[model samples]
Target: MRALQSDGAAVVHRDERAEGFVLLSPQFKQRWRFVTAHMGNLHAVLDLAKVADTLLFVLDPLDGWDSTGDYYLSCLFAQGLPSYALAVLGVPDLPQKKQADAKKKLGKAIEKRFPDAKLFPLNTEQESLLLLRHLAAQKQRHLAFRDRRAYLLAHNAEFVPSRDSDLVGNLKVSGYVRGWTLNVNSLVHIVGHGDFQMSQVDAPPDPFTLNPRVAKGQQKKGQDMEIQVSICPHSQQSASVLMQPRKQQPLQSEVIPDPMEGEQTWPTEEELKDAEGSLKKRRKVLKVPKGTSNYQAAWIVDDGEDGSEEEEEDDNMEDEDLMEEASQVVESSEEEELAEEECETMTIAESARDDLYDEKVDEDEEQMLEKYRQERLDQMFPDEVDTPRNLPARVRFQKYRGLKSFRTSPWDPKENLPRDYARIFQFQDFSRTRKHVFRQLEKEETEGAMVGWYVTLHICSVPISVMESFRQGMPMVLFSLLPHEQKMSVLNFVVRRHLGNSDTVKAKEELIFHCGFRRFRASPLYSQHSSADKHKLEHFLRPDAALVATVYAPIAFPPASVLLFKQRSNGMHDLIATGSLLSVDPDRIIIKRLVLSGHPFKIFSKTAVVRYMFFNREDVLWFKPVELRTKWGRRGHITEPLGTHGHMKCHFDGQLKSQDTVLLNLYKRVFPKWTYDPHVPEPVPWARNEQQLFMQELEME
Candidate 1:
């Protein structure tokens, strides 16, 4: 270790906040870049790891890793670990008799987290050299999503504000372009900021190697990258920029909504003539439901058997149903008004009782207990919402309909879609389009800097404050976006709830998602991760198995790993789930299942009378076709309505048990809430530097 330092490796960047080194020396086999920071500063670690190809963990011999180490390990593992090397420090200091036992215990613990990797002692210079060799020889695991895009790790960052506005400026960021060749015509995304366009890219000389041809005291080019970063003074803000682009990349995050879409529009003159001709010709049509033909329908029937009487009967029945519906609606409004008054009085009484006690309540404890209670109730009665007492059963569950078989039933994805769907872009055939785009990118000539080149990018209109973060140890990353990647689409991820976390993760709960290089906040709906046509919505993120998370987000191709995190009150992020992208499928159907329960009032031979399932005879008749089951496994269907009061005569396969409960399963297609935000503020640093002041503060407490 001392000999290597004597040889002198170049430090690409160094400051009070961060220190970076690029090993271009002849002693190393491959180029190596190292960035060191306190693990307590999570922002620095997460940003750096996204572009880093390998991770080296240095550990103590006696205590390999404390609680803090374990926390970081879990985060790294959840975020998809790159090639890693584990080096045990200070093995020579330990007593000879205890060294073997120490290594055995450490190996056991290491095996659980890193099954194939082994520990190396870093006490001797020879051991250190061997570890580096192993790292260089190890096969680099290529991540799918990142492999298709171009990104860079900035070694130098400088901002030159525009003459008009100090807030916006041309930020110069220089680094080695990795992955695919970067197209200057594309948009670049920074870590914290949303997206910006690069004005131009300048070919910079290799900062790692000194050029003998350049004269002394030349300011334009320098061998030291860090020294070149602070080239211009504050007073002299003007700096020479290369040729800028003639046009800018379009910033289109969503599809433009059409006001006339899905609405009646004026017909054309040709279409009016066609309509008149169609009205003149009377064509016999056999119509059932919009999509309900198991076999076929006979459109042409004998003129004598034209079914004229059947049509009259159907029209009369529809009229009577509409009249009954209008009367029930009036009654419901009156009942709802009375219910609201009772709720107001109850709230006032509760507040009056609260005035008796002083407000020293532990809100955190109370919230935790409430969360646990809700979770327990959900497990016992999954997806159970209180039955409305003010509204009719038919009106209350209008959006919901019963399914014969929850697994095999066909659901139309385009039916009953929310208005938000209009704002998103949908691919006609996602798989075919994905393949075509990649093939085109491969054949097209890249417009900007090629990969492995050290180029300076002048990103226009970047906030001056955003550039300062780079100097403060927050690693600023820049990645180019692919074609159509900015448009919003339905994204699915196959993720399993992290076993280390026990907090119940509910469906549609706001969570921070890290998809490879992108981080965003979304409340996603979870479904079964199977390849089935229809998937049942899960109330809880089950830790025992993997599930699919459906969210409306910017379209990112699969092969990218996913990490789900929940933010805590103390400003720390807890890892919830980890997985990879499943697909970008807008047609995937996610149905929320609701269970309605009622008790049997009377039991008879192969027949039973049920109550409390409906409020009137109309609702019983409306849902007569829906199949019913019991807790004891008896299957039945409603035969007839007993009376106006909610009682119904049902026929089961066998004798009904008086104590058994009757259950009905209803389903409705649910969409994720439109709560996607791409920006995540940096969290406060918790521990590093051995926690000197923090440890003292803790001891004082």
Candidate 2:
């Protein structure tokens, strides 16, 4: 029903009574009549022979007929219905497990019967609609064919002509030549096109193996496809009786030819010999002895009778032919010989190439050996020797000296020392021009606080304790003068602020060199303190403020000491400094006083072999210091007038028998400023003990 509706077929009632019978009957109806009163009980049992090309069977599940579906189908096949003719329709109450089995059985039964039926399994209403749709299609094709608008082509013995279709119009058929045979209901079947599946099927004849009559008929039919108009030849002569059309039906069985008729007769050896003897006799008859009467057979040489002029021309060219054949043979032989010679030459060349390759390899190995030998010689006796083990390189580190007073000093015009201190303190002037917001403080007080700020010296990290101490004096306060709503505070280290203030006094008075600082907007103790010390001060400082300071940031320092150098030629020791001069003026640096003092005590007695000197004002602090030494030079010298003025170079060439003794003596005498104070308690006694214990365990282990 769905398919019919999709194809646009109309539904109409022609036999109302018969339709009711079909709906009520338990058996499937075989046929339908136009008269409504001529209805009969639809017997579900099928008669294969009576079934038409279009068989419509409608079954109903609600009527309670079940389990015998396969049996019912068997009856349809038994009566000779074509497989494709039958249509089974129903809402059969078939169990899921049994459905497959039932379908298989029904399919087998149908296939056994007609083998080409188009079986449709559908419900009652569906079967009725499908049949109607098929009938309507037939009517349409019939009208089209009647109008000569469509051509019908039939295939096989079941010859139903193709109802006209615009899609496949006027097609020429070629394969196998024979036209289709169709039944009245338009069902088609091929007569000889009944080829079975290769497996489990009888082998089909090869293309050449033909049923002779059928083959001839097919050929004739193919030729008939090409229509020819006959033209009469002008023939007044009467035609012969031998040329009549064939009317005899060809016999379809095998026929034996006459060639094998004497196969049953056996020949004796003598008879076989006689047959051979007859051939010998014929040869002997052809041979004529030279002197015999039959000897000069005229047939042997009748040139004029047997030979044409073309034969004489061929005979004249025979010498040239012999010459050409001889040349061709010679060329072929020469080619073969040349190929053999090439092969022998290639073998000899390859052998020579191998020899040259071996020689090159041997030369390379010799070169490598020579290089290895030279390297070994170089290792045994180096070009230059290093200094004796007892002597240490001459190098020195010393303190700097500076002006005695905190006030600005005059610069020497001759030496280029500034007459006005501004030149020396250019950065300080620049520092004053910078802007800073002093929150909630008088202008005079803010100005006074901006005097001389101090910075902590550190190699790397800032000391936390020092920073914390500085933070205690700096408290948070609202900056009313500022436009930004953020809160800020300023530490009043008066000297760093202006000239001097009470807060500055409260801060440590001494310029604590090497005191590191980490800047923080909030207190370092606040939750906002970052773990890193080198972060931009802007993180902690306001944009308006030029500088911020934190004194307790961690500091890293290398172990450095002021050491004297002894000139290799001299045996004098010099004292580099007097006090623990954290910083010094350049003039006060005792460069001459610096000397190398080793184990045997280079200073025989005290003529003051080493003495410190306090020079005229010239010094450097953290910002101004000398550059350190280079690895290759005898010693480094500072040309700058910064703290570098104190640099000294001394070398020790005197043999130091014991290095440890020399180091101890040098350390004690040269850097007298370095000492361990027993009065000051050790900060980490446990750490010291643990280190000792670790060393002991390492030794034992």
Best by TM-score, which number?
Answer: 1
Instruction: For each candidate, give its TM-score against the true structure.
Output: 0.78, 0.14
How do the residues 326-428 of candidate 1 rate in per-residue lDDT, one tens digit apiece? 4585488679978975664212245434652463444665575566567667878777765566788888889998877877777888898888998898989
**Candidate No. with top lDDT:** 1
Q: What lDDT score goes with residue 285 in model 1?
A: 57
- Range of the 10 consecutive residues with the lowest summed lDDT in candidate 2: 663-672
Residues 1-701, model 2: lDDT tens digits? 23222222222222232222111111221122111111111121221112123344443433222324433343333223331334554436677776667676667665764475555555554565565545433321111101101111111011112346322211111111111111111111111111011001011111111111222233353232111112223223332121111222221111233445435677899999999999677653334335323322321222233333542343333334444554475478669978975664212245445644543242465575565455554445322122122332221222322221112323232232222211111112221222232222224222111111111111111123222322332111100011111111111110122211111111111122111011111121100112321112121122222222222211111111111111111222111111111211111111111122212112221010111111111321221222222121211111122122221121222222222121100110011011111121111111112333443344334
Return the TM-score for candidate 2, rounded to 2 decimals: 0.14
